[model samples]
Target: MIDIDLHMHSTCSDGLLEPEDLVNAAGRAGLGVIALCDHDSIAGVARAMAAGRARGVEVLTGVELSVAWQNWRDVHLLGYGIDLASPELLRCLATFAERRANRNREIVAAVNRRLDHEGRQPLDPDDVTALAGGVMGRPHIARALMARAYVASMEEAFDRYLVPCDVPKTYWPMEEAIAAIRRAGGAAVLAHPTSISTDFTVLERLVGGLAAIGLDGVEVYNSMASEAEAAFLQGLTRRHRLVTTAGSDFHGIDPGDTMGKGRGGIRFSGALLPPLYARIAERQEPL
Candidate 1:
């Protein structure tokens, strides 16, 4: 069966690989279908699509939107099969891009203030920008920290500075993000349902509410979910009649986060792709 990875990132977001390089890596991993779900930005989609063609791999137009739910700061929503030319969607994403940049800078500034006490040289914004493919985020900053010898690894960078120095991030409301995805002819899936809340009761309510409002699917198979958690999520999707997807949530900074196959040998069967495609097609229907 052909393997499919429905969620991942490129340098367009926090990922280490360039768009084409990511596609090439996916090709090497034998992923028949993959989606570049960069954080709030689809800038890499076009380039990845071109690379996909060259590699004979199917690249879906996707974006990982950060959404604000009730009392939740930044819940992730995965949008698949989005229309790249959707003006409203493009405008919405542009706002996210700007917000992310501002947040990155703010975090760097905070980190710099802390670095001042250590008597270490501060990181240049340009150095962080150099690491990003297009849209910059915290991972770029983490790389900047590593390059400056402020941290030994990405984990250390985040632990020592990135997390503590993080600034408030602005995001579209959950409803707005879901509506935008639908309007753009895409399937909006909840990424790693566990991230929203570990409590099954709370998660059920969230998923049920989102399904009522137009959530098309959930990430039932991912590096974040254990077999039991995946099974629970699968049941949740079944109850809500939502399509299910698998992804590595790969950024390529960690050695364990593989492209097609995620950590612990997670694999997605080709069966997951049909329902996802059908959901996207359903969204394309005129109201």
Candidate 2:
């Protein structure tokens, strides 16, 4: 059986751990397989895969595409088994990276101005780039704040400053993201649907639209989903004939904690892979 996690991040994105460190940590946590679903980037996949191989863990190529749905913002689309070299896929991701950098600059400037009002040294966007270059996310900014001791903790940084600019002004249209995943020969799963909206009526419509747009799966077991929410999403998964996916959404929150474990140290089992693999394989078949 595979002890697996379908989502995670590394220094290549918002996460603090380097790609190799994340994979190595997964191995230590007894994970047989894991996915590097970094936000809008596959830059870490190759290094993680190499580390996974060395550690006897199978690394699945994954990317978390950010999109918007309805009033909801920052909806994540997890693309599994993607072709990192897909030109179209790269083109779309490049746009996201550019926007993310701009957002980072804005967040840093805002936080610094606030710090100045508080009579303190301002932080530079370079501090975030020093952490991770390609994609500068809110978490990266939060870390920089923490580094300066501007905030006692990440939670404080977020609540006091970072939360104001969390969402990107622009995101890939949901349809375009799904289309990119398809073109990359991967399965697109809606990530943590309930995190943004818990109303079944809302999710029903959301899932329906996503299904119609070539989304292949629903993230039924996620760290943020309550038991009741998971059950609700599981019902949607069944209703839409979608594959169920799980992940820890790890961002180096606790170095001692395992990357694959969720809120209560719960990790996904390998039992999920057979069906998911089947679906990806079926999709790749000439239709």
Candidate 3:
């Protein structure tokens, strides 16, 4: 009854812990296998893998790609077992990173305008960037706001400034993202499909359409999915012939969110890994 968590984050993205500390935490949490699925960056993977080796935790190379599908502008695709050196994958991630940086600048500008209206000092984009270990994210900006005493907490930063001042995120087209994962020799699994839509009918159609376009698996057991929703997703994967996986989506910022187990005891059995591994291997096979 080994436990595995297929999704988590580190300072490489917006997560609170650094890559090495994240792995150490996972090792302490008793997660046998874990994936450091940083948002749009794999810069921390090597460090995390090294820490994993030392901690006796099996770290899988993973990334959470932000992608757009249809009218849904913020869907995430998790790529597992990816080739860190894949040119196509690297190119796309680099492009997204630049876009994210630009967006952060825009967000700062907007935040500055609000601050000006309120007669407060403006946030410096450089300061926000300095807070991020890897790719700049909203969480970094929120920390900047906190440091400036503009917001009391991360939530207030988002609700008052970060969310309101957000520039639209540029996203890879869903098809292109899935193709990039395949090119990188990885399995592209939709992370927390329930976030796209909790309505079963719409969610089913979305999953079906993605499956038709090369989605390798669906994350059925996710922290975001309710028990009933997870059950439905399990059946949905069977209906679409897609492999199923689970993740805690841990970022280590929120309270009560465990590593191997999510909030409310959402746990994944190691049994989920075999099919996912098989799918990743199938993608890696010469075509």
User: lDDT per model, in order?
Assistant: 0.89, 0.84, 0.90
Clash pairs detected, candidate 2: 2-270
Worst 10 residues of 1 by lDDT: 255-264
Candidate 3: segments with Cα more than 4 A from true spot: none
TM-score of each model, in listed order: 0.96, 0.93, 0.97
Lowest summed lDDT across 10 adjacent residues in model 2 is found at 254-263
Per-residue lDDT, model 2, residue 243, is 92
TM-score between model 1 and native: 0.96
Residue 271 CA error for candidate 2 (Å)? 1.0
lDDT of 1 by residue, 1-287 (tens): 89988888999998999989999999888899999999989999999999999999999999998898888878999999999999999999998898889888888899999899889999888777777858888888888888887788999998999888989888889999999999999999999888777788888898999999999999988888778788888999999999999988999998787877744787788789889999898888888
TM-score ranking from best to worst? 3, 1, 2
User: Which of the numbered candidates is closest to the native, going by highest TM-score?
Assistant: 3
Task: Count steric clashes of candidate 3.
Answer: 0
* Residue-level error in angstroms, candidate 1, position 172: 1.3
RMSD in Å for model 1: 1.3
